[model samples]
Target: MRIITGIYKGRHFDIPRTFKARPTTDFAKENIFNVLNGYIDLEDAIALDLFSGTGSISLELVSRGCQSVISVEADRDHHAFIKQCLKKLGTDRCIALRGDVFRFIKSCHQQFDFIFADPPYALPELPTLPKLILERGLLKPNGIFVFEHGKNNSFEDVPGFIEHRAYGSVNFSIFSNREPEGEDE
Candidate 1:
């Protein structure tokens, strides 16, 4: 995969042969960042990338100037690939951690300005991620948590769910902390 934009744009990294993680496609990524560009002040944000896979999202965040990014991955190869990418990009702004995402979520107490979770679509517990995050106060008061999933599932009924967007077969559910303008007191 390649860094799509910013100072590190055009950089490339290979997904290790041993890595079984599925990466977000370039098409979806471009669109995601486009949306992010509208609401995010990249330099002021702290990002968390859970179920990090090949770290595409993290790298993209870093490229766009996020202050710091914590990438969490469980697989050894996948985690290593993230570290490798950071090193290659000469980015000291990101932290790559190897651990189970669920366990890591329970253990982490620090809050982030943005949190992105792209868990395995087939995982039965997928529906609970937003609740888990809210219960733990992982997102800042006005932060966003984006969950990427396959097209088969929809989060429209889930509380705190603000918006859902689809880019081809890739889908994203956005949860936010801000109330819309002109809402009730």
Candidate 2:
């Protein structure tokens, strides 16, 4: 996969066949970023990428000039590949961690301007990720959490859901920090 825009535009990485990630399609990624462009300044943003699979999203964020990105992946090989990719890309802005995404969220004292999660499609617990993130307070005030899932999944009924964007088989359910009902929680 390659970065489709920004400073690293046109740079490509050959993901080994052993890698199990289904990297976001360039078309989808570009479209998503275009939509985001109107709202956020990448250089002013801090991001978190859960299940960082191939590190593609993190790299794209860096390429687009995010202030920092914490990218977490549990697979040993995937973690190694991400590390190697970061080194080759000269990216010190990304913090790569080898750990369970859920556990990381629970333990983190940090909050991100944007968080992207792309869990395996077969994982039955995907629906609960947004709730988990909220319980752990992983997002900054007004931050966004974008979960990428398969066509069959739907998060529209979820609390804090702001929008659902689709590009063919890829679906992004976006949740923002909910406005507290009373007393500011």
**Cα lDDT for residue 38, model 2?**
60
RMSD of 2: 2.6
Q: Which parts of model 2 have CA positions greater than 4 angstroms off?
A: 178-185
lDDT for each residue of candidate 1 in 45-131, tens digit (9 for 90 to 100): 999999999999999989988899999999888888899889988888899999999899999999999999999989898888878
Q: Model 1: which residue pairs collide?
A: none
Every model's TM-score? 0.93, 0.93
lDDT of 1 at 67: 92
User: Among these predicted structures, which one has the highest lDDT?
Assistant: 1
Task: In model 2, state the lDDT of residue 36.
Answer: 70
Candidate 1 yields a Cα-based lDDT of 0.88
Clashes of 2: 0
